[model samples]
Target: MINKLNKSYWENRYVNNQIGWNIGYASTPLKTYIDQIKDKSLKILIPGAGNSYEAEYLWCHGFKNIYVLDLAHQPLDNFIIRLPNFPKNQLINADFFEYENSFDLIFEQTFFCALNPNLRTQYVDQMHQLLKPKGKLVGLFFNFELTEEGPPFGGSVFEYNSLFKHQFKMNVLEPSINSIKERQGKELFFIFEKKS
Candidate 1:
């Protein structure tokens, strides 16, 4: 049976223009994290990356080895229009779970919360598998209660700690101090390195 939250569900969301999770620009916490990274050549992946402003920022900052993957084509097309010079090959249209690749870093935004709660473990495991040794998975996660009525389902730091600790070294997981004004205090910034 196809998962209820599979491609069709997400595609419909894009088709209907119901992407409230899209912040329309590189979010502050993520931008700050990317700003301090000294290396410009690190391979990076941003899955479930709807109209990925972060990818655009990275590309503009000379991070050419950046990939933005999404199941729907609309956002990818929007990204292409927004950054016509961005390498076409790096705009991936694929399922995050089935996508196969290794990266120096992967960014998490609202992607995790958009997924079904039952898949949290799989999300963590896939993130581990997709990273190179010492690779980092970094971004913001919602800091609140999880509920069925959400694509923006919330989560807590304690839950994140237990989920990621076994496969990743939790380098940072704390309430985001620099989130966009609306998300401030309701999100946690995290950086988790794959456990060798």
Candidate 2:
């Protein structure tokens, strides 16, 4: 399953326009979180960032050090067309595991669930590795039972805690009160600080 979710598979998703996960704008929970940030110079990364509207929102709001990474190239191309002024060097198209950089903050949108469940441990480890000490990983996760079938897989809060607790300090992991209508009951908002 992990092998099948490779670069070509995701590129094909874009090519065929089957990007059901593209919500077309920054998610409200993330935007609200970004609004409270007083420091505009922190380096942030959005992995698996397909047509990253959150990056667009951040850039517009004075967060200029944001980096958007995706395995598929098509979405990054689309993003450049939308935000022509965004620095091209910050737009990365590479395997997340192979990419190396420490970020002060990393935003997780649909990226986690879209990965094959088999790779969740590696995902956690890589996230820990890529975060600066005391750096944060924040954003949303789907609230539902995990099953065998899905690119949009699901998990409970309990499951998430078990997976991330060893390496991250969970500052907040709860049903998001401020989620958009379509995601109101289906999202878990989180802020996890990488352990020192």
Best by lDDT: 2
Collision count of model 1? 0
TM-scores of all models? 0.96, 0.97
Q: Clashing residue pairs, candidate 2? A: none
The residue-by-residue lDDT of candidate 2 on 1-196, one tens digit each, is 5559888999999999999888899999999999999999999999999999999999999999999999999999999999999999999999999999999999999999999998899999999999999999999999988977787889999889999999999999999999988888999999999999
Please report the candidate that would top TM-score against the real structure: 2
For the record, the alpha-carbon RMSD of candidate 1 to the native fold, in angstroms, is 1.7
After the best TM-score superposition of candidate 1, give how far the Cα of residue 155 lies from its true spot, in angstroms. Answer: 0.9
Clashing residue pairs for model 1: none
Error of 1 at 64 (Å): 0.3
